[model samples]
Target: MPAADWRASRLVPRRAAVSRAQVETVAGRALGAFGLVFGAQTVPTAVDQARFMADGSGVAMMAVVYGAIAALAAATFTRVAVRAAALAFAAIYVIALLAWPFLVVDAAGMAGRTPWLYYLCTVATTAAVIALPVAPAAAYTSAVPAIYGVVRLSPSGGGASALIAVLDTMYAVILGIVVLVIITMLRQAAIAVDAAQEAALERYDAVARRHATEIERVKVDALVHDSVLTTLLSAAASRTPAERALAARMAADAVRRLDEAAVEVPGLDDRVALTVLTRRLRGGVAGFSAPFIVRVDGTDGVELPVEAIDALSSAAMQAMVNSVQHADGPIGRVRRELEVRGVGAGGCVIRVIDNGSGFDPAAVPPSRLGLRVSIEERMVNEGGSARVESVPGEGTTVTLAWPAGVEGSGE
Candidate 1:
């Protein structure tokens, strides 16, 4: 495929996919807000029924139930303790239902009117759906409405007809089940998306590594054709001392080139000082179109495989280029930083950070080789890893680490 056509086909922007966590957050907040609205609607009924309750029990029930609902509503906007709020709303509503008969001043006097708790049955079940797992949520959904049904049959629960009570119970159960099914499906779909994305990334990484290997193989082949093959042809044709000496020199040059190629192969014993790697990184950063605040530390005497140095340097430079191209905004608006530091025995870590126009890492198209190929896969090919953290409009940080358990490496 033509390069532009290939990129155009694969690089088309995909609609940002929502993860499970994001789905849950939206569900929680929506349920909480709905619960609050339903709770508010119950206020007048609660006031009218307050007369039938025993001393202080009516006020206490209102306080506890309303307080829980209020907490649920408050949790809609804040991330703190959301599950706890949902649990409290569901559990408190159940407890209030169970205590209704005992709290009533005259059980029979409550006949013909629905209890305020009846308005919140669906709300409680919705909270349970948000707070618990499918099995437990289903159980809670069934049990809470059944409890309300029993309370409904009692005199304090308005002495409703069996048929009426059954209808109400079924209504709440069906609604709860509907909510449960919808939420469970959404979560399952989100999980599937996450799994698919992870698998695609793994496949892309493997393909990228294979591509790098093929390029190296081609380089070796080219070296053989240009150097070794030519030297052999020249040596075979030599008929004089001067010509033979020239052929011998050509053979020696080819041997040196072959030796260098072997050293360049990954996993070789050829080592370079950490300082050499850092120096290269510094030079690259200095040459960038925009200045980067560079910091280097603890790279004095450490040594690493030559392949590792090359991979790290290339990945780090690619990360910087990505920042400059994508993250850098107007002049003097963005602050870019590059840090190269040695860690453990001889491993190194590089970080490129920019306070500029950030982006969603998850939204990046697979065809963007600056990240998946030039940075991430390059590090993985060298037995290292890269992490990119960014939020749209917040900032971006790309961290590259070599030799995976570098923290605990012994001298």
Candidate 2:
């Protein structure tokens, strides 16, 4: 909307707003002080008889006109315009010296000769200019006239000049210290503003990244639900009774794994412990051979990334479903033993042994899609491999092994 509002919005806190205003005030004072110094030099040079003032009368008329103009500009204009008016006043003062230098140069007789009404007007105007936004600088420059008047009115040239010199020098020294302090404060304010702006930008960037990541997660989940989930449902619906038994078992296993995975946030993996896994499997693949031996034995304290655990769990569930459903004989004819053996290299082996009507794995066909996802693909994703061994009418066994904390490739 407005420039002021833009500054206010960025301020963020009330203290900052107040500090910024104070800084602006001080900067204007600095500008005004410089303006007064310029005027001090200009006034002396313009009136010197050594210069264009070879004729004195010309200076007075010029000074009078300049004074009137400077007064008007200073009084009517804003704080910024007061600077130009100060120099204008200096110009007018020099010109006035040609006719009325008595006002500035003579301290004792000024009130005696000047009309009372005119004197009041001069005082009011001078006070207003001196107190303008750059009052500090104006006060610094005013030291010149104060010193001149003290020297001019002194009974002894030595005492008065010495007193004026010392007082004026002290005033300048104090003024310089104050100006340097103000400059230091301004520099600090600039640095603070930069830091605040940088923090705001960083916060904005982080929020944007979080939002983008959430959107990507939703997209991936939607793809899984649409393609993989739909195929499982369709296959289950169209099977014969004997086939339907197997399909239902597979469907149940797939749904459980999907449900577990869905709970994980998009960037995290959803695996849990392997012991927790076998307990879950016994419920699904009912004909699993009894007393499965899972020997992490004493190495059971190992923890894994949730994602790797999730993939292994799903893979085991898929392999068991294959053993239970794909057999040519009844469920009672199936024999199975599932074991988890921990390895020394921060890895684990999942072995599924079964006695059932077995077929040549290669001739039986490319691995089923769920087996591809849960076994072969899952094992590879988890930094190991999967193998299926079978001899017809003898038995079948599938072993999937994986590294415990395989890092993602960032592909």
Q: Please list the C-alpha lDDT of all candidates, in the order they appear.
A: 0.79, 0.48
Model 1 Cα displacement at 34 (Å)?
Answer: 0.5
The regions of model 1 sitting more than 4 angstroms off are: 1-14, 268-411
Compose the digit string of candidate 2's lDDT tens values, residues 245-331.
766766776676567555654446533444544444443333232223232231254444555555566677667656544433332
Q: What is the lDDT of residue 118 in candidate 2?
A: 19
Poorest lDDT segment (10 consecutive residues) of candidate 2 = 6-15
- Backbone clashes in candidate 1 total 0
Model 1 per-residue lDDT tens digits across residues 31-50 = 87888888889989898898
Q: Every model's Cα RMSD, please? A: 11.0, 31.0
lDDT of 1 at 127: 90
